[model samples]
Target: MTFLAVARLGRYTAAAEVLGLNHSTVSRRIAMLDASMGGRTLVRTAGGWEITDLGRRAMAAAESIEASLRALGEQAGGDPVQGMVRVAAPEAFTSAFLVPAVARLHRAHPGLAVELLAATQRVRQNRSGVDLEIVVGRPQVHRAYATPVCDYSLRLYATADYLARAGEPRTVDELAQHPLIYYVESSLQVDDLDRAVQRLPASPPSIRSTSVFAHVEATAAGAGIGVLPDFLAEHDQRLVAVLPDDYAHPLSYWAVVRDGPRSTAVAATLNALDEHVRSVGVG
Candidate 1:
């Protein structure tokens, strides 16, 4: 009961309240859980508790046990393989790709459920309980599995109004005066990116964003000149290209996943992602 409550409520005190137990009792039960696993499973936080690495593993174990138990109940009826797949992806990815795929997945697999978590930060490995993560940049080949999804073409764009007001830039040198919106890059050095953008003779962007989607939306709203992925920019007639199509930039996108329990279901999902790659055409 304490375990279920803690997992449900995400805090010891709240779990204690839900279980109708004293706070100390809840504490003891959790400590027992730690002892059962031979280590601490969670760290106490001022606002709540964070599951430790071991706690994450223990949680998976508990889930597997529950699944086995449910399998027994399912055996009496017709049980298609059923489970919840947790996916971690950027807000843009959720909006652009994964969310649209959900409806078809549901129709194809009536019993399987997908839990999509929108994250502004880069998705960590399975240790963070994210079964799959889609990232925009170079694929991590070292991980259990990574597939290049698309080139994710990036180019300068501005709203029709913003461009009309500022006037279209005819030469690379003219870019210095206009307000531009850029992404504040990380992991990858911005110097190389800056050098490339400098080739266009642009003044630095007035507004910078970490989110590609945010940059796209802001540019469409006449915030400033910014880059947008082909998938996004192609759909919006309000946004126009600032640079020629031949302009060169470096970046890519990938879908990453950890090794799941060997199964046809997991393999099929990977294959599906691979198949989707071809459909993501170039800019």
Candidate 2:
């Protein structure tokens, strides 16, 4: 189990946490395994450990065994409807939108538990840690099952107080005269966001951050104008939309599941998300 965890997460500390072992223990076990095989299974790197060719073969065999065990456990049912479902998505969406939707899903199915990995890092379909992913743009995994789950709009916003103080700028060119807040250039992961950046005025923003939450907070503090997702700012009375219809950037959210026989629980979770998108106005 320790080896499997390490192989799956590719990080000793993460594997240790999942397996309830010390970091040193996880490393020691891997070292022991390598010594027993009289070959290096994983090569240590500054970032993390990478599997050797032999380790890849061994991991493949281990995965097959794990799959077999899972199949045997599922013999009593078609697919599991109760258990943990790990979903990865951007932090902004998780806090602003998905939290309430997932809460509803949990209320309907009390036995199901959802593990949310809310971060900027993109989760891959082949990654063993996550069961589903809500991707911002097109997923790179071609073989994975992917579909557009929802559409949301982003528009310029400023605090009501800020607008009152600075005066509202009606057009893009007028908006440029005021201070702005935006994402850092290097941190942009979505192609569509780059286009949005292109639409910005030639003036540089007064504030920049890699986190969407920061952008929202800074904008709300009357620091500068910010482009934020409608779902996040729409409910906050403090924020007023700036040229919403004219400058709104349309974006689609995609749900991706690894290519394989999905469990009943996963199917239900996907269904719930689809329903939420349709029924609940995300924006």
Structural similarity to truth (TM-score) of each candidate: 0.63, 0.71
Clash count, predicted structure 1: 1
Question: Where is model 2 poorest over a 10-residue stretch in terms of lDDT?
Answer: 119-128
lDDT of 2 by residue, 1-283 (tens): 5666665455787677666689999889988988877898877655456577888777777767766866776795544456666788888778766677778888877878888987555545344466678877666774468887777877899998999898898888887788878778787777776667587786544788888889899999999898888888888788888877669788877788764325556777888777776787652
Stretches of candidate 1 off by over 4 Å are: 1-81, 120-126, 141-143, 185-205, 260-268, 275-283
Which residue pairs collide in model 1, if any?
A: 176-203
Clashes of each: 1, 0
lDDT of each: 0.63, 0.74
Residue clash pairs of candidate 2: none
Deviation from native of the Cα of residue 125 in model 2, angstroms: 7.1
lDDT of 1 by residue, 66-135 (tens): 5676577568874443454556666766777666565466677777666777764543432344446677
